[model samples]
Target: MNFDLNTEQKMLKDSARNFFSREADKEFIREMENDEKGYSQKMWKKMARLGWMGLLVPEKYNGEEMGFLDMTVLLEEMGYACLPGPFFSTAVLSVITLLESANEKQKKRLLPKIADGSQIITLGWIEESGTYSGKGISAKAELKDDNYIISGTKLFVPDANTADKIIVAARTDNSPEDPDEGISLFVVDLKGDLKGDLKGDTNNKSINIEALKTIRSDKLCEVTFKNTIVPKDNMLGEPGKGWETLNKVLLKAAVAKCAEMSGGAKRVLEMVVEYAKMRHQFGRPIGSFQAIQTGAAC
Candidate 1:
C-alpha cells in the first residue's frame, strides 16, 4: 500500500499552508495570545469563506461534505502555523459530535449555522476530577417541566468564553452499578445579553467563565453552570446512552490532535535545521557537524 495524499488532499494542505503563512504569522499569533477572545474574527470570517468551517458538515447543511482524512490534512497545517482559535473546538469536536448523535431536526437547525461560521460550539466534559472517564462526569442534569436544569462545573473547556453554544455532558441518572450509564449530552445555548469581553447573561443567571492561562496560551476556560436551563429538544443522542457518542468524539479528537502535533513537530524540525545551517561554531556551520547531522537525520 502506498502512503500518499490524494490530489484533493494535497491541494488542501498547500492552500492551508499558504493561508496561514500569509494571514497568521508569528506576530499575529502573538497578538491573539494577548487578545480577549484569543482569536481574530477577521481571520475566522476568511476561513468561513474558504469553506473550512464546513469541512465535515454534509452538503445538504451547506457544508463541503469532506471526510476525516481531509480534515487531518488541514489540521496539520494549522498546527504547523500554531494557529490560535476555536476551529478545533467548533469544527472538529462539536461537528463530529453533532453528526454522530444529533437528530435530523437538531442537525438541520444548528449544522447550517455552524457551517456558515455563525455558530461556535465547544465540548464541556472534563470536570474537577480532570479525568476523561465516566466517573469524571459528575455534573447533574435534572429534567423539569419542559427543560433540563444542568448544574455542574467544567474545567479546561476550550473556547467556552467565545462559544455560542456548549455540548455539556451531564449525569441524568445516578446508577451506582454502572458509572457510564445515564449520562446525557445537552447542547446548551450560551448566547445571551452580551456584557463585556464575550461574557453573556442567560435567563437563569449567567454562566460564569474564568479564563485559565495555559502554557500554550490557548483559550481554555473553567466554566461554571449554576442551574443552566436547556430545552428538552436540545439533547443529543438517546438519553442515558450518550457515552457511546462521547466516546466516538474523544477518539476522533485524539486522532486530530495527533495530526496537529505532527505538523508542529515538522515545523520545529525545519526551524532547528535552519538554525543549524545559519549559526556557525569553531569556524564551521553547526549543520556541517556530524553530530548535528546525525541528530537531524533522526
Candidate 2:
C-alpha cells in the first residue's frame, strides 16, 4: 500500500500545523494548563466547524468518515503544539468507544452532538484504588424494573468537569464466584445526574467530580458516583463485555501516548540543535563539536 499522504491529507496536515502555530502558542498553552477547564470552547467550536471532530466518525452520522492514519497525523501536530484540550478524551476515547461498542440508537443520538461540538463525552473507569486494570469496582448497577441503579465511585476520570456524557463501566452481575465476568459499559448523563463540586461530574449527590493535575495539566479529574441511577438502554453492547472494550481503548490510548512522547522528543532535539547553532564555544558554534553532533543524532 502507498504510505504517502494524498493531496487532501497533506492539506489538512499543513492547515493544522499552521493553526497550531498561531492559536496554540506557548503562552496560550501555559494559560490553558493552569485553568480549571483544560480546554477552550472557542477552539473546540472552531475544530467542530472545521469537521476535525468528525474525522473518525462515519459519514452517515454527520462525520467526515476519515481513517485512523489521518487522525494520527493530526494527533502528531496536536502533540507537537502541546494543544491544551480534550481531543484525545473526546475524540479518541469517547467517540472511538461509542463507535466500537455503542448501538445504532446511541450513535445516532450522541455522535451528532459530538461532531458539532455541542457535547463532550469521557470514559469513567477508575476507582479509589486507582487501578486501571478494572479492579476493586465498588460501582454496581443493579437491574431494577428496567433501569440500572448505579452506586459507587470512579476516581481520576479524565475531563469529568466539562464532560456532557460519561461512558461508565460497572458491575452488573455480582457473582462472587467470578468477579471479572459481570462488567458492563453505560453512557450516563454525567453533567446532569453525575455532577458534583471539586471539578467533578455536574451532579453533587449522584456523581462528584474533582479536578486533578497531570504533568501536562490538560484537565484530568477524578469523579465519584454515589447511588447514581442509570438507564439500561444507556448500556453499550451486551452486559459483561466491558473488559474487551477497555482493552481496545487502552491500546489506542497507549499508542497515542507514545506518539505524543515521540513528538516531544523531536521538539527537544530541534530546540537543542537551534540552541547549539547560536551558542559558540571556543571559536565556532557548539554544534561543530563531535560530542554535540553525536548527541543531536541520538
Candidate 3:
C-alpha cells in the first residue's frame, strides 16, 4: 500500500489546518459551547462559501463529489480544532444516509440545501435503550393514509436544538422475533406544527429539545416527539429495514470519528513533545530529564 496522502489531499489537510488554527481558537470553541445553537451560523456560512460543507456531495447537487477519503481529511481537521455544532450531524451522518438510501427526487430536493449549508439536518436513533442496535430502537411510527405519525424519545441526539430538520428512526411494525423489522427512517421538519417558529425561541409550544450536559461538551441533545407527523415522501429508505440501514450508517460514523480522533491525538502528541522540550525544571529542560523523556517516549 502507498500509505501516503495524494498531493490534493495533502493540500486540503494543510489548508484545513491553517483555517481552523486561525478561526477556531480556544476562545471560539468555548464560546460555541454556550451558544444556544451550539455553533455560529456565521462560521457555517463561511465554511459553505469555502465549499467545505459540500466536499463529498455530488457536483450535480452543488457539491464537490470528492468521496469519503477526502471528507475524512476535512473531518480530521474539524476534530483537531475541536469544532463545535451540527457539522457532524448535518454533514456526516445525515448526508451519508441520504446518499445511501434517498431516491433521486429526494436527493435533488434535499442535497442542494445541505451542500450549500442553507439547511441543518440530524439523525435520531438512540433511545432509552442506549444501544446503537435494533434492540435499542423502541420509537413507534404508524402509517396513516399518505403520512406517518411518529412518536418516540431519542436520547443523546446531536445538535437537535439548532437543526432545521431531523431524520428519525421509527418502528412501523412490531415483531418480537425480528427486532430489526418494522424500523423506518423519516425526515421530520422542525418547522411543522410549531406554535411560534422553528427556532424554538418564541416560547416554544410543542418542540422538545433538551441538552444533555456531559464532560465532553459536544452539544448532545434529547428530542421527544409526540404524535409528530411526517410525510411519506420524507421516508429515506425502505420501511422495515431501517435498523440495517442505520447500522451501516453508524459504522461509517464510527470510522469518521476514528479519523478525527487520530488527528486530535496527533496534535496532542505534538503539543506534549513541544512542552517537554521547552519547559525547564531543576536547571535543565524537562525533556532532558529521564522521567519526562520516558513519558514523552511512551
Candidate 4:
C-alpha cells in the first residue's frame, strides 16, 4: 500500500499549515502561554467558522463530518504552532466518547452545540493516582431515585476551568470481580443548564475547579465534585459498562496526540536546521561542518 498523502489530505495539510502560520504566530503563542484562558475566543470562533471544531462530527449535527485521519492532519499543524485551547478535549475526547456511546437523543442535543463552538466539553478521568487504569478511578457515583450523586476529584483535567460540561468517569459499583466492570460515564453540567427532561439542581456550586500551574500553562485543572447530582439520562452508554467506551476514547486520543507530537518534532527539526545554517563558527557556517552535518543527519 502507498504511504503518501492523497490529494485532499495534502490540500488539508497545506491549508492548516498556512492558517496556523498566519494566525498563531510566535508572538501569539507566547501571549497565550501567559493568558488566563490559554486561548483566544476570537481565534476559536474563527476556527469554528472554518469548520475545524466539527471536523469529526457528522453532518447531521452541523459538522463537516471529517474522519480521524483528516483530524490528525489538522492537529499536526496545531501542534506545530503550539496552539492552545480545549480543542483536543472537546473535539477528540468528548466527541469520540459521545459518538461511540451516546444515544440519538443525547447526540442531537449536544453535538450541534459542540460543532458550532457554542459548547465546550471535557473528559474528567484521571485522579490523584495519575493512572489511566480502571483501578485508578476512585470517584463514586451513587444512584438515588432518578439521579446519580457523584463525588470525586479529577486531577489534570484539561480546560475544565472554561468547560460548559464535563463527561466524568465515576465508579457506580463499589466492589466487582473486575476493576473495569463497574465504572460509568456521567455528563456533569457546570453551567446549571440541564437539557431535556434531565433538569435538576446541577450547577457550578456543586463543583470546585482550580487551575493547575503547568510548565506550558495548558489550562489544566483540579476539579473536585461535592455531591454533584447528574441526571440518570445524562449517563453515556449502559450503566456499569462505561470503561469500554472510555478505553476506546483513550486509545484514539493517544493516536491523535502522537500525530500532534510528530508535527511539533518536525517544526523543532526545521528550527534546528535553520539555526545551524545561520550561526557561524570558525568563520564558517556551523551547518557546513562535518560534525554538525553528521549530528543533524543522525
Candidate 5:
C-alpha cells in the first residue's frame, strides 16, 4: 500500500545523486570513455570505501548485506549518471551467482575479494547466436583429467578487458534430447587480462578477447576460448543445473536493469523540460506552448 521511499532509502538516493553529480559528471565520463580500461581505479576504490561494491554480499564476507531493492535504488542512480565499468557484472552477476550456487569454500575465498573490490568478475553467457536465454549457451566444457576443458566463444561480454575472473556458461553434458540439459557454469580466472589464458587452467592454449565498439562506447568484447581448462572445483552449481541458478540471477538482473532504465528515462525527461524552458521560439519560451507542455506531460 505504501509507495513512498522510507527516510533511509530517500537519504541513500540523495547521497548517490550527490556523489554522481560531483564525481561522475559529463566531463569525467567522457575522459573515462577515452581511457584504456573504461573505468577509473580511483573511483572504483572510492565506491568500495563507500560500501557500494559490497552492497549485495553477506555480512559474513564483510559486505553490507543490503537487499535487492536497496541495490536497485543504487543501480538507478548509476544509470542516471551513466556510470561506467563492471559495477553490474561484479556486483550483480558475480555476487548473485556465487550466492545462489557456490559452496562454502568458494564463498569464503572469493566473495570477500569481490565485496572488497580486490577482484572484478564478469558473466559470459551469450555467444554468436546473440541470445540471452539458455539456448544460446553452446560453449562446450568437456570433462578431462579431473577437470573440464572449455572450448567456444562468447560475444558481447561486458568489461572482459578489466575483469580478474569470468563465470562462463558452457555445455558439460551432451544430451541431444534437451538443449538446456547439458549447460553448466564455471568461474574462469582471467589473471587480469582479456586473454583468459590462465597458466594453470590452459594447456598451452590461448584465449582471445576482441573489443567491440557500441554507440555508447561501453566496454563490450567478444571472448574466444580454445581448449581452456578449469579445475573441477570451479563449477558454480550442481552439474547440468546451471541454468536453474542463472535463471534466478537473470530475474534479479532484469529488475535491476528495469529500475536503472527508469532512472535514465526520468533524467531524459528532466533534460527535455529544462531545454523547453530555456529555449525561446517566436518570442516565447517553448515550454509555454501547449504542444511542448503536452510533450512534457507525457
Candidate 6:
C-alpha cells in the first residue's frame, strides 16, 4: 500500500490544521467546555459549510466520500485544537454505523441532514452492564403495528443529550446464546426529547446537556431510555446484524481516537521542545544538560 499522502490529501490536512488553529482556539474550547452542549453552533456551521461534517458520507448524500485516512487527519487537527464537540459521536460513530447498515431510503433521508449539520446523531449501544463488548444488549425492540417499542437504559451514551437523532441498538429476537446476534439498529428522533432536556442554553435553548467529568473534558453522559417508540422503517438492515455494524463504527472511532491521542502526544513534544529552548538553570539551558536531554528522549 502507498504510505505517502498524495497532494490532495496533504492539502486537506494542511487546510484542516489551519482552520482548527484559527477558529478552535483555547478560549473557544474553554467556552465550549463550560457550555451545556460542550460545542459551538457557529463552529458546527462553519465545519458544515466547509464540508468537514460530510467527510465520511457518500457523494450522493452531499458528502465528499473520502476514506478514513483523510478523516484521521481532520480528527488529529481537532484534537490538537482541543475541540469540544460530538464530532466523533455524531460524525464518526453514528454516521458510519448508519451508512454501513441502513437501507437506501434510510441513507437518503438521514445522511443529508447529517451532512448539512442540521442534525446531530449518536449511537446508543452501551447498556447498564458498563461494557463495550457489544454482546450484552438488554434493550428490547418489540415490533407492533409498523413500529417498535424500545425499552432499556443506556449508560455513558456519548453526547446523547445534544443529538438530533439517535441510532440505538436493541434486541429484536435473540437468545443469550447469541452473543452479538439478534441485535438490530434503530434510528429515533430525539429532536423533541433532546430539546426538552437542554431547555435554556444559548442557541440550543431548549436542550438540557450535562458533561460528565473525566480527564478528557469531553465526557460521555449516562442515558436512560423509557419505552421509546421508533418507526419500523428506521430499523437498520436485517435483524441480528447490529453487531457487524457496530463493529465497523467502533473500529473507525478507535482510529479517530488514536489520531487524537497522537496529536496530543505531538503537542506535548512541542511544548517540551519549547521549554528546552527557553528554560534554563545554572547559567545554561536545561536542554543542554545531558540528563535532561536523555529524559526528554525517553
The C-alpha RMSD of each candidate to the native structure, in angstroms, is 3.0, 3.7, 3.1, 1.5, 2.5, 4.4
The residue-by-residue lDDT of candidate 2 on 1-298, one tens digit each, is 8989888889888998899898888889889888788788998999899888888999999999998778887887787887877788888888888988999988998898789998888998878777777556658888887677788777778788888878888998777455556889988786664333112333436777778767777676777767777667888998987868887888887887776666666777889999999998798999999999998997
TM-score of each: 0.95, 0.91, 0.93, 0.96, 0.94, 0.90
Across residues 171-246, which tens digit of lDDT does each residue of candidate 1 receive? Answer: 9997757888889998887776434312233563547888999998898999999888777888999998888888
Q: Which run of 10 residues does model 2 get worst, by summed lDDT?
A: 194-203
* Per-residue alpha-carbon lDDT of candidate 5 for residues 1-298, written as tens digits (9 for 90 to 100): 8888878678779999999999899999998888779998888988888888899999999999988889988999998998889899999988999999999888887888888888898999989889777787889999998889899999999999888888999998866577767789998887634242333353324578878988888899988999887888888889998888888988988998998888898899989999999999999999999999998997
Per-prediction tally of clashes: 0, 12, 0, 0, 0, 8
Q: Which stretches of candidate 1 lie over 4 Å from their true place?
A: 193-201
RMSD of 6: 4.4
Best-matching candidate per TM-score? 4
> Which tens-of-lDDT digit does each residue in 1-298 have in candidate 4?
8888889788888988888888999899899888888888888888888888899999999999988999999999888878889999998899999999999988998898888998889999999889998999989999999989999999999999888899999999989899998999988888776555336344669899999998888999999999998888999999888899988998999999999999898898899899999999899999999998888888
CA shift of 25, model 1, Å:
0.5
Runs in model 6 with CA error above 4 Å? Answer: 174-176, 193-211
lDDT of 6 at 245: 83
Q: Identify the runs in model 2 with alpha carbons over 4 angstroms from their true place.
A: 176-179, 193-204
What is the lDDT for 52 in model 4? Answer: 85
Q: How much is the lDDT of residue 222 in candidate 3?
A: 92
